[model samples]
Target: MVGVLERLERLRAAADLVAGRIPDALAGKVDDVLARSNRRLAVGPQTVVALAGATGSGKSSLFNALTGTRLAEQGPRRPTTATTLAASFTATNADLLDFLGVPRRHEVAPPEPDMTDLVLLDLPDHDSTATAHREEVDRLVRVVDQFVWVLDPQKYADAALHQRYLRPLAEHREVITVVLNQADRLTAVELSQCLAHIRRLLDDDGLTGVPLLATSAVTGEGVADLRRHLSRLAAGKRAASARLAADVTVLAAELDRHVGPARGSGADRRVVDDLTRRLAGAAGVPVVVDAVRDSVRHRGTLATGWPVVSWLAKLRPDPLQRLGLGRRPELESPGLRHSSLPARSAAAHSQLSSALRAVTAELGEDLPGPWRDAVAAGVREAEPTLGDRLDRAIVETELPAERSPAWWTLVRVIQWLLIAVVVVGLGWLTLNAVLGYFGLGVLPMFPLGPEDGLRVPVPTLLVAGGVVAGLLVSGLSRLVISAAAGAAARRARKRLEYAVAEVAEERVLAPARAEVARHDAARAALDRLR
Candidate 1:
């Protein structure tokens, strides 16, 4: 189990982590409590107990009786003691008094030396009609190590005392003592009835186990008992720590109401995958993939088609260039060049928006209103930059068509050899026709089938065989290139999608997830205090 000091430290860490995220009022309270607690701990081990009550409650007289010295003055006025009067039982309490901001201080010698480290304060009336007096009491109440509430018979059950002061201090019962002052005024029967009523009222305020007694500052009816109680608290030397612990417990409870459940792992992987696909679509991945396929086929045709018709292929547009993609010198520097891919269609924007909303919904699920709003706000802030990020991802991705495969080179060589044979046969036929027209000796023929029965001319055979073989090779190359184009398109799609996924994670998921992590951190610290 964690100690009170450890819990207090955790509470401080939590408060700092959630400073700007929670409500201003709650955040301010956390700051004020921590500041007071730290300053109180720094002063000394001396227990600083305060006499807190409404006007005409005889707090000043009780203070004088407890110290055996007239440290605080008593008068017939409605409100007395606008400032605090301190009585330190020890010789070296000037530092503590200075820290408490009390200028009027006195040293006292008590019967018990064990109470030497005690420092008692006579505070202003908490319910005083004077605003300054009430403000002084309220300020000291927050930092005092313990409280002694002095009540009178007539107003023992005053609503302002119970509701405003006692009820809120219910968690600090261990550091609080209640006394019904002026007990000498009431008869025995009436005193018994008042004590019973006070008991019931304390129970209702959730301060059931707190010490209660009746004392008259003048006759000293229960003053001896109150002194002993205060002595025990001082001797133990744990009152300050106990008081701080109670303060932390109350703050933790209030903060826990605003903390939601923890989601430590961040965005779900499945949701991320869905988001990647949507982002890829918005980035025009499909268009890029189709361009890759068409670019490959266009280049393949120029490389392997018949020389006669190959010049015609140059007349058509290059698919990759049309999209402002492929291996361009300007595009070598990442993020500097934008593609000519068309503007994102309405459907693409809708999908992108829907995907982003899904991410926000998942992150904000089960969270408190403020934290959920924080997550959504983070996503919305990043939404405008997403389009630019996606475009950059697409431009930077390496497509397959950017580098030609080795097979295309080998096929191109074979096609040139076939074209060479066709050229030789066509020249031979033209030379033979010119010779025969000029009545020169005719070129010799070659035997084709059974030598004497069937013979064919050499030029005709050369011309016929080369034409048939060239056409056959061209047809086969078309099938292979088509398959290769499809495979290249598939590879390009994979790379583009990968790039888009990175954009989604960096631009969309990371920030939203960070907010969730922050909430979890604050919540976990508060949980330890519980």
Candidate 2:
């Protein structure tokens, strides 16, 4: 039980939402309907019915007969009734007449008791040669509450009238009545055939069940019945609201074409994931992951490598530092600084474009052409900023920290101790060789291999064992560092993938989804109006 006002509001909301996104002509038509409906409703409850017809159709005659006055002039010229004229059966119709812009107004003399609160307007011919006359007819036709189309036997089926007015206004069947005005010219058989033919034509125009009357203004044929119908319409005081409702209904139907049934939820997870993968590639996720891995390896080598060669590792650049990554500058400051990652290649851009199209197509699968194009256009409009957003995402992403493990410190101490033993063994052997060469006694030899077996020097054992243990410890530390590097790379990939997903959501998918939501909202409102 929605009221006419509620339906009108729904139509207004839908039109506003879909205005620019739809075609210009349709948007303009919706605006016109809203304007005319609001104005007609604002003017009181007086029923303003117009006698509308083509040139020489006896519309003025029908008007005079219906109002019981000669307020309109009838003529045999090619085109008559150059301006709109109105006859008010009640005294309180000035507001409606002013709203209709019909200045030449007349009060019915000896008004019929039955035609109370009726304002019968005899509008200029819709087919007038003068542009002003036709414009006036067009303007009044849109705002009038009801229409009594005064047609003659000859031009009743005229294409100019049916195509231009009747077919288009089929939605207003409840507020429209067709009159065969000049029916005296036809015999009874011809009139019946003419009425049947006109009925068929009305039915073709989707105006079936509309009141059709054969009235001769000159012979007063069926004029009383037309008057009674007008009296009933005027007494009900619902014509204005009904006309507005019909207008809203027609407009809502037209706007509904731009939308369709909602498909799946606006987001397609598969398409989104694919887009994220493409975007991650474009954002240099792999490069950053590799950098993380290399950075970890470089730091570990510097911390645990033999001291003699560890300084050489420092000469090579830190991979994370070279990329200006490894730190979240965005968090420390206001804006993100760009990373030194390589620019996206042309192939990457092409892949990104295809991914964006896929996203739009998936979301807009159920939309009409105009709305689908609208969704695409909205997404494309954000493309220029997408690169910057992605760069920001990469810069803001946190990589694995380059903290040294505790085992590296122990490894370093063990290597130094081994080197010290080697140094002491070399010094002792140098002292013994010098003493033997100078004819002084050598220091006492402490080591013999098994008591009765071949003996080995203590200095020789000390140097060889120290060197082998140091090599083994260094080799084991490297294997641990390699495993840690792989772990760091995996962690970096996870972080970068999350950041790229955010960029995809904010830059591409969000806008496309919003367009889909807009289409759904407009469709829902139009359905409620229906």
User: Would you list the C-alpha lDDT of every candidate in the order shown?
Assistant: 0.85, 0.85
Q: How many residue pairs clash in each candidate?
A: 0, 0
Top candidate (TM-score): 1
Candidate 1 residue lDDT tens string, 129-201: 8888888888888888999999988777889888889999998898899999999999999888998989999
Off by over 4 Å in 1: 264-270, 445-447, 450-456
TM-score of 2: 0.89
Residue runs of model 2 more than 4 Å from their true location after superposition: 78-80, 109-114, 263-269, 328-334, 364-366, 413-466
Which clashing pairs does model 1 show?
Answer: none
Candidate 2 Cα deviation (angstroms), residue 428: 6.8
Task: Tell me model 2's lDDT, rounded to 2 decimals.
Answer: 0.85
lDDT of 2 by residue, 7-66 (tens): 878888988778677889988888887787777788888888999998889998888888
